[model samples]
Target: MKAWQLTGFGLDHLVLNDIPKPEPGPDEVLVRVSAVSLNYRDKLLCDGKYNPHLELPITQVADAVGEVVALGTGVTRFRPGDRVVTNYCTRWIDGQPTSKETLYSLGNTLPGALAEFLALTEDALAAAPAYLTDEEAAALPCAALTAWYALVEKGQLHAGQTVLIQGTGGVSLFGLQIAAALGATVIVTSSSDEKLARVKALGATHTINYSRTPNWENEALALTGKQGVDHILEVVGGKNLAQSIEALKPGGQISIIGILDGFDSTIALFSLIKKQAVLRGISVGPRRALEDMLRKFDELKLRPFIDSVYAFNDARAAYDRLEKGAFGKIVIRVRD
Candidate 1:
């Protein structure tokens, strides 16, 4: 089997090599990976920013779509020929998360999907949506699920509501599509006008070039006739939260998912108190949530927006594309 192993932190150390193929455990399944998706976290993992102490020589991705070649004993839910997608957090099943459930996150605490073959617990897999191609399904495990969790599960987003999504990244684009599908008006922000125009074609009711208008919050507020948006998918943390609060309607929800701007910031409590806004932090979400989102995808014919695809041999180039900034998910096709 071929896999990209990180013997040390940094893209320079990510080596593609042949290694012994893994066999399924008693409760696992061996999947022949067809496609794998890249997340911003994969870059962090490579640069030693995500976890400096992570063990070396580990496989490097969590989200993937594959065909089950063999099923281990006791795995009744899936069988040979099933096309499945992986759960980013292998142990998070349902409801409130526990530390134990989040311990073995793929590409971080355990070996991941950046290989021709992978053996995963039956619990960590879900039936891929029939409407999606392997590369599109590969994008669902993290970015799509995170958006679903934040908007649908946590925020209880509904029709007629207005939502503010932070950027043109994977999660935000998903947020735009999901919010629009649910009948919500979407306000999208980006640093690029061209990207803003692209998102508008995808159902964004309004778009703001945040770079041109640094106080994008005011633009959001004005767009809503000074009442502010009902929900905000706040990906940029740190000082950005202050502006997100400003863009929120009283009692509106803000699901915090990213810290791309910076990790820490001084937040003024007065804003939260004045607006009575809800700030909820989101991780990738549970397996059950993934299942629920997939059902929605199937019913609605929702397709993930794939910005680009690279062949398996071009894994490093895929990482470079992710690093540069992608309008949607970046994927690597492991096989035809």
Candidate 2:
């Protein structure tokens, strides 16, 4: 089998080499990986930015789609030839996140999908949406599920509500599409006018060129006729927090999902108090949430926007492109 191992804690240490295929545990399944997707977290892991350092020589991608090649004893839900996707939070098989569940995650604390063959528990896997290609299914477990958890699960978004997505990154783009499918109007922002135009084509009712208008919260406010949006999917944390607070309608929700700019930020307490706004932080969601998200994807016929596809051998180049803030999800075809 071929695998890319993170030999050490830096980008320079990723080594592609041959390794023996893994055998499944009694309750596990061996999947022949079809595709793996890159997220911003992959870049941070390569650069040694995650809080808990990953063990050396571990495989590194949390989101993937594969076909089951063999099943170990005690596994019943899945069988050989079943197409499946693993949840990013592989240990959180039931209930909300706990200290125990948080301890083990694919790609970081455990071996991940960047290999020809990988073993995963049956509890952590879901049937991949039949409408999506393997490359598209590979992109959903992390970013798409995070957006679904924030908007649909925690935020309790209604059909007539308006959603404001801060950027065109994977999570925000999924937010745009899901909000639209739920009958909500979507407002999108991007640093590039060209990117903003692309987002508009994908069902964004309004687009803001943040590069030209630095005060995008004001633009958001004006777009909503001074009432502000019902929900704001905030990715940039530090500098943008105050603006996100200002761009919410009274009692509106803001899901803090990323810190692309930086984590530390100054907040205006009075503004949040005045509007009675709710701020929620999200990690990648649980397995049941992933299942629900896949159901929605199938029902809505949602297609993920893939920016580029790299052969499995070009995984390093895929990480480099993700680091450059590419417009959509970067995919690595693992099998075909």
Candidate 3:
């Protein structure tokens, strides 16, 4: 089977090569990967920025959609032809995250989805939504699930609540759609007016072109008549935290999910104190959360926004596009 391996710990270490196809163990299933999606974490892994360094010669990318080709003994949840998507966090099968569950993530501590065939525990796989193509399904496990956990599980987003998403990246876009599906009014922010306009058409009721209007927190406050939004999906870590803090109403929540803009930030202590705001950090999510998200996708017929698809052989090129900050999810087709 053809797979892309990280020969060492840097971007220059990645190389494509042929390796023996994997066989499933007694409790595992062998899946023929159909498509793999790129996330910001993939870029960090390539750049050697992820903590708990990945092992060399390992495949990259945690999120993928595949077809089960062989099921090992005791694997009863899946069959040979079932279309499946594996959870990024393989160990968190149920309940809150534990040290054990956090230790065995796919593509980090174990083998990943960037290969033609991957062997996984049956517990790590979920049936793909019937409405999604392989490329679209591939995009869900990380970014989509993060959004669902941030807004649905943590925020408890209700209909008619207002949501503010910091950027138009994969997770933020998923946040927009999910919030919209739940009947929340979504406000999107982007440095580019063009991108903001595009997101508006996708159900954002309002957009703040952060480049043109630098004080976007004021704009958000004005848009809500000084009450501010009910929730915020914050991606920019250091530079935008103060503004995000000011853009929330009393008791509103902000899910600090990414550090696209650097890790440190200056915050207004008074705003947090006065608003009684909740700021929570989110990892991808658990297997049960993935299941709930798939159910919602199926119920709403939600289609992931795919920016582009590259062939498996061009996996590095896909990473290049993600590093350039392309809109939506970038995918690699592993099979036809």
Error of 2 at 245 (Å): 0.3
List residue ranges in candidate 1 displaced over 4 A: none
Model 3 TM-score, 2 decimals: 0.97
Per-residue accuracy of model 2 over 241-266 as CA lDDT, tens digit each: 89999999999999999898897989
Off by over 4 Å in 3: none
Best lDDT goes to which candidate? 1
The residue ranges of model 2 lying beyond 4 angstroms of the native Cα positions read none
Tens digits of lDDT, candidate 3, 260-307: 789898898988999999999888788999999999899999999999
Sort the predicted structures by TM-score, highest score first: 1, 2, 3
Clashing pairs in 2: none
Report the C-alpha displacement of residue 206, candidate 3, in angstroms.
0.4
Which run of 10 residues does model 1 get worst, by summed lDDT? 98-107
What total of clashing residue pairs does each candidate reach? 0, 0, 0
Clashing pairs in 1: none
- CA lDDT of every candidate: 0.92, 0.90, 0.90
Global fold similarity of model 1 (TM-score): 0.98
